[model samples]
Target: MSARLGPGRTARTVIGVVIGGLFAIPIIAMVEFTLRDGDGHSLAHWAALFDPENARQYAPIWLGLGNSLVLAVVAIGIVLLLLAPTMILITLRFPRLRRAFEFVVLLPISIPAIVLVVGLAPIYLVIGRTFGTGIWSLAFAYGITVLPYAYRAIQGSIDATDVRTLAEAARSLGAGWGAVLTRVLAPNLRPGLLAAALISVAVVLGEFTIASLLGRQNLQTALVVVSKQDTYAAIIVSLLALVFAFVLLVVIRLAGRTQGSAPRTARRAATAPSARAESPSDPSDPSRKGNNT
Candidate 1:
């Protein structure tokens, strides 16, 4: 006889299925629309994605894509370096500060990007006007704006890690704090780091409000440039962004699975041999279960 799922689990499963369909349906429709030809289903849009004329018309597409990638990588790296240590420190040394830190970290979400852009414009204008380099300026903006998402992702990871115990164990083993953090905590926090990095990338790639408001020539700006002239290409750009987001989801899922499975495997490896050694008779082993306990 099959075991029955509990009511709560059944309800959750139903809700999950509904939500999944709600998201998937629109994506499927977009793909269908993008692929449909003027005459019939065709590869024109997909082909146009690689065309030289398309690039010329959408000059910023290439530039914006490159800028976006750079922003994502740098922003994600900065976030991990800054927030990981901060989270660990807060959780380990000053647990009481967590609420305050969280409140401050989450302030970005409460403030509109438009407001942030307006506030930062004067400062960035001076730096850019003086230095004649908006490259680092834009990157810094992207990185700062990504803080809330990145912080939450990493903070959740740090919280789940029981970093205090790990750090103590490492110290007992004569490892320095740096060594402990790099080896023990970072490895365990990989999933959260992956999620945070991808989120930062997604945010940077799709961020139009701040970049446009700041008059920065970024990916979002490029999208806007083409969007006014060619709605079709704009839709294609949107499709490509969706594809990137889907790829990010896959990466996060795989990372989560790898991280989640390690403890189970380690436990089995550590316990199975001990169980065998402790058994006076063979019965406890599955191979000899019929013989004895």
Candidate 2:
């Protein structure tokens, strides 16, 4: 006989379905809107986005996509490079400052994007004056925006692992600090790093406030520009972006789950042979008889 779900499980399922439906309705509406035209349902708006013939018309979108891709890469790289080493060092050497580090990283979440833009304006102006208005310049601000997310992800991974023991083991094996970080710690933190990167990419892709206020033409800014002329196509693009972000989030969650299972599996495998070896010997068995003799 199959076991029935308890009231708690049933309630949770109901709540989850409700939440899913609530979130899904907007996407459904957007999809319907994208498919609908004056006469009937159509896909002209979606097709136009990808049609080579309309490249000239969609130049802003293509340019913005390219700019956003660059920004995402640069921003993710900056976040990982900056945070990984710092977090590792803090975990290894400055354990007392961990709380302070957490506070600093999370501080950005409290600061509104508009306020951040206001503060970054002068600094960006100086940067633009020195380096010109390259889109990559936005990566610095994007990195800052994603710091809280990246920090939490990385910190969680660090917390899950025995960093001190791992470092000491690596060191005893003649691994230097660089080798310890790059070869030992980094591999273990792959899930967190991937999660942090995906979050940063999503944040950069959807970011409008900072990029728009800074006069940078990112994906969202370009979508806004397109919306002025062709609202339907803009909606289609927005729906597509939403779907892409959803996929990334799903992947990050799966990665985290996979990472969580790995340590348990490894530990079980490592102990299984030893456990068998230590098991009580059967009295009638040859090994047991020989030991008794």
Best by TM-score: 2
State the lDDT at 142 in candidate 1: 74
Number of backbone collisions per candidate, in order?
Answer: 0, 0
Report the C-alpha lDDT of model 1 over 1-293, residue by residue, as the tens digit: 23454457678799989999898987787778778887788878778868887678767787888877777777877777887788889988999898778667666655677788888889888878788765556777777677666665565456556789989999999999889889988888776777778767777787777677777777778877877977667778788887987787566555655555444322221122122222332232222111000
lDDT of 2 by residue, 1-293 (tens): 23454457779799999999998899899999888867898887788778999888888888998999999999889878888889999988999997677668767766778889999999999999999999999999988877766765665566668889999999999999889988999898777777778878887888888999999999999999989988887888888898898888777767776774455322221221111122222122111111000
Q: What TM-score should be assigned to candidate 2? A: 0.84
lDDT of each: 0.69, 0.76
> Candidate 1 at 100: error in angstroms?
0.3
Model 2 per-residue lDDT at 29: 93
TM-scores vs. true structure, each candidate: 0.76, 0.84
lDDT of candidate model 1 versus the reference: 0.69
> After superposing candidate 1, which stretches have Cα over 4 Å from the reference?
1-29, 261-293
